[model samples]
Target chain A: MDKGIDRRDFLKLIGIGGALIVMDTGRLAGAADNKMAQDTLSFIQLSDTHWGFNDPKINPDFAGTLRKAIAQINSMKSQPDFIIFSGDVTHTTDDPKERRRRMGEAREIIGGLRLKNVKMMPGEHDAGLDNGEAFQEYFGTTHYTFQQKDVNFIVVDNASDSTSSIGDTQLQWLSAEMEKLDKDSRIVVFTHRPLFELYPQWDWWTRDGAKAIDILMPYKNVVVFYGHIHQEHHHMTGHIAHHAARGMLFPLPAPGSVPKRVQIPWDNDQPYKGVGYRSAVPKKDAYGYDLTEFPIIKV
Target chain B: MTNIKYLLRIMVVISAVVLAFAWVHIARLAAETQTVQNPVANQGHEQVIKITVKRFDYTPNKIRLKKGVAVTLVFTSLDRTHGFNCPGLGVRTDIVPGKSNTLRIVPQKAGRYEFSCDVFCGDGHEDMSGEIIVED
Candidate 1:
């Protein structure tokens, strides 16, 4: 993957502030190399593991469910370039030590996957407990950006606050990051909560999401993949396509379809019903991606 | 003698009127404090607490249950999906619109237990929590 560009040059291009024109040149070059990067540019997303959650009626073996999900991803016909756990890595608790232990257990289980480049963001369950210290301890910065096949993947933490906001600091960083790219750059944003107002009554909307949306309005192709509602949903915010993924733990009722957010119960026969993940492939010479849903393998 | 008789008669009438007013006040107080047994508690379903969760709040957000009684929480969402997560009780349920979710819990200890919506349903998801108060 390392062409002639050294580490310094690569960093200088992707870096913000002083790194604008260089990034533009690199992006132009990236356009030519995108065809070769397309095949291996696909990635998998699994979310709402709720590792510490245990309930006989809903999901008794939460960890086991995640293992089966990993098995499914590992046994895929082709490996994805990376895997991203959108958020809610573990169920939040008042005990910080217990939360850390759950995070450790989740890491050990997720580590069993074949892919090495796994990135994670925090759902409210992981961040809202201790204000994201435990989550940051396991997974570095909650919000960050990386490039793969000319597509920029921006992962941010909006669950740190009960209001589901990206905070002023993260918002500033997001704007700065967006400034480094041209309007035509393919940007895929991964967040724990829906950036748009999916349903405010149920706390499905980000408090300060419009600010971030306003910043990205100038961009031609901005797709968002979020996990919180634990269902397969798609929305359009200007040019951006917001898609929410299914959870690994349990699925919830659709927005406005239910009065409260409750887990969908498993059938007597099919216990793993409605439990699944998704894989996405960024299209070449375009700003959108194709998504495919895969259900968890039955035990 | 006639004047004395008349004075006694007037005093008796006033006493009777005062007594009648006191009786009515007492009756009203009794009615106000009367514990109308929640029909849900007596359904022979062991334990049941029907909770209605809506966009911004949960109906009966403060539940007082008898300690050591097994309780089933019948949760329903009125607007959108809301989570009923009680970490202390190790109970979590989703209240979906148009349907009901049930959670069974037995409170062995008398204490305050808090629960909230774990799922992000909207901007107010954080404040969308309730508490269960158990009494001995």
Candidate 2:
């Protein structure tokens, strides 16, 4: 409860606490409100690592950036309960062999983290063309829901499909899943692309996301965390909070902010300027979680 | 067994009546012969088509052309890096933003061919594609 302990320090502090709590990722999303403790529960969300991507102008040190992120997470005084990689774990490659190689390298890099409980979703780059074949082969299911304490974490696969949609089957699955949760439950949804339309012109919006939004409208507290756009963005639809995290590889200009959707030029002096990760802790009683972004800065 | 046989006979009769009606209509239509014109003839011999590649879609999703005529595609992207690849036609070009890439062809045959974006622009990259229709 030290006010001086920022999120980064807080994560380092959490690791020292006793007992490795293994909560069900399922109950983590739908059924664990009663288990909510007075203390806040926190976790890290990292996205768009773009492993194996070789763009010197945008991010020449892409591999080093990831390694640095893992180092930061590992050096924490206390470790988060789990870490969630929102999507785009690997950059796109038409060669299936290269794609698998990138996935393996990404897995090996992320394996360095002290936290063992890791959850992942897909970025369109990972699953879009292959319909999640390569991603599923490496990361398992594209969509699922889990629970931790009083919070519900729903991870849907909107990236693997070219339409950038949570397919009809996953949409129906979401609706049916919401039926089982209380209207007052705190729900956190994670996907690779924004669940609500951020900017359709840049392919930022999911085609049928409104259907998923409609299903969650009844819920009192709902927040979405996604990562396709490659920058930090916050938008609200009704009571739902939608947040896009900063990608680990590079940043893209805001919607229509530029003439085209190009990577923000890397600051020569500042290498990993706008790229980083985020952490959130639950609020009292199931209202919502407080969020903080930690950018990777040079020492 | 008898009831099943009767039902089959009724179905066969109904099909026969439907076929007879279709035959009469065809016979009457055949008697009313009309001249059909080739629309491609009016479209000129050489054609220029511009395609703007956005995130996951091509502005001109379908391009119409006359067989054995020159067609030029002036391709540019409104967004990130995209590629145009038509394997059947052996045509591939990179569509970069702020620049135009042209692919020219004179299709020798009348048929439909597809072109796709092979570059990884974003999550919707796979969905970016268009078609070419050559009319005889």
The number of the candidate with the highest DockQ is 1
CA lDDT of every candidate? 0.77, 0.75
Candidate 2 regions with alpha-carbon error over 4 angstroms: A1-38, B1-136
* Model 2, span A150-222: residue lDDT tens: 7888888887766556789989999988998999888898978877867654567776789989999999889
- Model 1 over residues B85-136: C-alpha lDDT tens digits? 6756766666778886999888888887766675555434556767788899
How well is each residue in B1-136 modelled by candidate 2, as lDDT tens digits?
9999999999999999999999999987765542122212222555667677888888777778888888788887887667777655767777889886988888888887776675556545646767778899
DockQ of each: 0.07, 0.03
TM-score of chain B of each: 0.68, 0.65
What would the per-residue lDDT of candidate 1 be over residues A69-142, giving only the tens digit for each residue? 88655644356788999999898776889999999999999999877889998999888746789999998788
Query: Quick one: best lDDT, which candidate?
Result: 1
